[model samples]
Target: MSGLLHPFIQLGYGLEFKCEALIACALAQASTHRKQFSRALDTETFDEIRAGDLDGGNGLSLLDIMELMRIDPITDKITYDDDPYTEENRALSQTLAIKYAKLWSVGNSESSVREKSIEVMSVIALVYGSLTRPGYRPVLEFGVMHNLTSSYFLPILLDALPLHKKVRLLHAYAFTFIYIFATKGCPPLHIPPELTLADTHRAESAESSSSGNPWMEVIDKAIANNDMHVAKVVRALWRLSLLTAFPTQPNASKGYELPPYINCLYLARITVDSINMSTRRDSVTDKLQLTAQDGRRNWAHGMVAYDEFWAKYGQAL
Candidate 1:
């Protein structure tokens, strides 16, 4: 019990507690004071886990509590749900926890900027599942984090991985997480019941045919129009695509460069839900252009803010 309970105690205490303290507390509660530890794993545990107030591990980790309670030699009811803890639920919860913990740990580890960035990216990739709507669904629909954090993780994570790895991971993570998010229309931080593999694949195929292929379509249109401005926008989009292909700076010379394509993307975003012929033309007008200086400033500001944020609360990542 002490061994199994240690992670929970650590997580409940926000992992800020020392290992020795965690051991002491867990043993003291579960063994010396069995009543207290039992209560700790009861309804009270749910709030701490939900709030992320726990320490070394997530409060609801399958390995830490759910699995132990379900798979133990004992045969008593454990979960808050009225239903008994079934093998299926236990397995699903454990799979989720293990993957969640690994990525969460990476985003929380003590490492260099480059290493930390890579880990963060990997974590995002793991969460997103693919580059399409299917991959992004789980994270976005989970609403566990705001769309800003949830949607951005993939692009950022791809920045950290090796160029070769990023492309593949991006495809997988983006497709899975995006599919979860877009279809469900949920916020980033929430979680849903089990999502089937078939539904996810179907969503991926549909998105690939239309929305995911928007850039190439736009480029083709730009080429036919002989529009330099539109051509530049396409070029920028092409560059932004590279960012996902190779997320992080490989060396000193390969520092961050803002992709100019986002201007058109953002413009598209502001008007996607509404369709006015005049407004559409106006949005595409020359004034809609985004300048390099604007891009540089925005990139620099974001980078500085991210670095500062990590430097201050890096342990929590």
Candidate 2:
């Protein structure tokens, strides 16, 4: 989860393409970043929780755990001014994140793994789409965007692991999600109203005559764009759309329940459109490179002020 998710992402790519060298490089990268959170992540308490020994042995769903983090007073008090990466702050945040995250049980069955993976993917996508401030230029926050992209690797990583390791990975991933939400000023999450299948069809049909299929348009733009983030996000969202095409009732037993409004296709469209609009107004390449040089300044690592975010790239109403 550290290194702004680079190691995790690299490992995903390695698993995805079956590249041993990339996998090795990712492990090497991960080794370097583990010490900072080792105290928080490597404790017996967390291990017990991960093993389903706590919370009645049937932990909360991932979304439920997220809600807990959102409403927790302590998390709400954490702000960008607090400098969350400092050793003291990082330890505190990680402990809190792990506390909430442990309440989400990683079920033992393969079916449970699939369900949890989809749930994680859906929740992150919902967050990415929902974080945009109303009346703004619709630019997705760079920091929040990584959560969505990094989650793309979950299914890939889980598929190759055994049941025990799968549980461990899921626990760590859930913890990372909570930690990010807390550190990013605990931004309010306002998920849009549910988009029924009919609603999505009508919306797509309305745009198809002139645009020739909204999904294709998004895919085309993503492929043509030089931005890796653009391509990765589009691809991930497209996969999510397929995985979540058939809406299901919220079943607490499965530990995965998506809200009615979280249509992956709709979210994907919004993401690409926002990225396009944002890039047109600024040098995304330059900004990405400059931020990459300093991880803290990188849009994915820092806290962006809401007002500054609204006016980023000199964008006007």
Q: Measured by TM-score, how close is model 2 to the native structure?
A: 0.77
lDDT of 1 by residue, 1-317 (tens): 22332333232343333346754564556454334223223454323322322233322221123223334332122222222124443334333333332322111222222342333333332222221122221111112122223333334444446754443333233223322222222112211222111122111122355555554455565454322333433343343334433435322113222111122233222122111112112355646442332111111111111233224322220
lDDT of each: 0.29, 0.64
RMSD in order of candidates: 20.8, 6.0
- Estimate candidate 2's RMSD in Å: 6.0
Per-model TM-score on C-alpha atoms:
0.21, 0.77
Estimate the lDDT of model 2.
0.64
Report clashes for each candidate as comma-separated counts.
54, 1
The global Cα lDDT (0 to 1) of model 1 is: 0.29
Error of 1 at 199 (Å): 22
lDDT of 2 by residue, 234-304 (tens): 77776666566555423555644554445666666665555532223236544423322111122333443
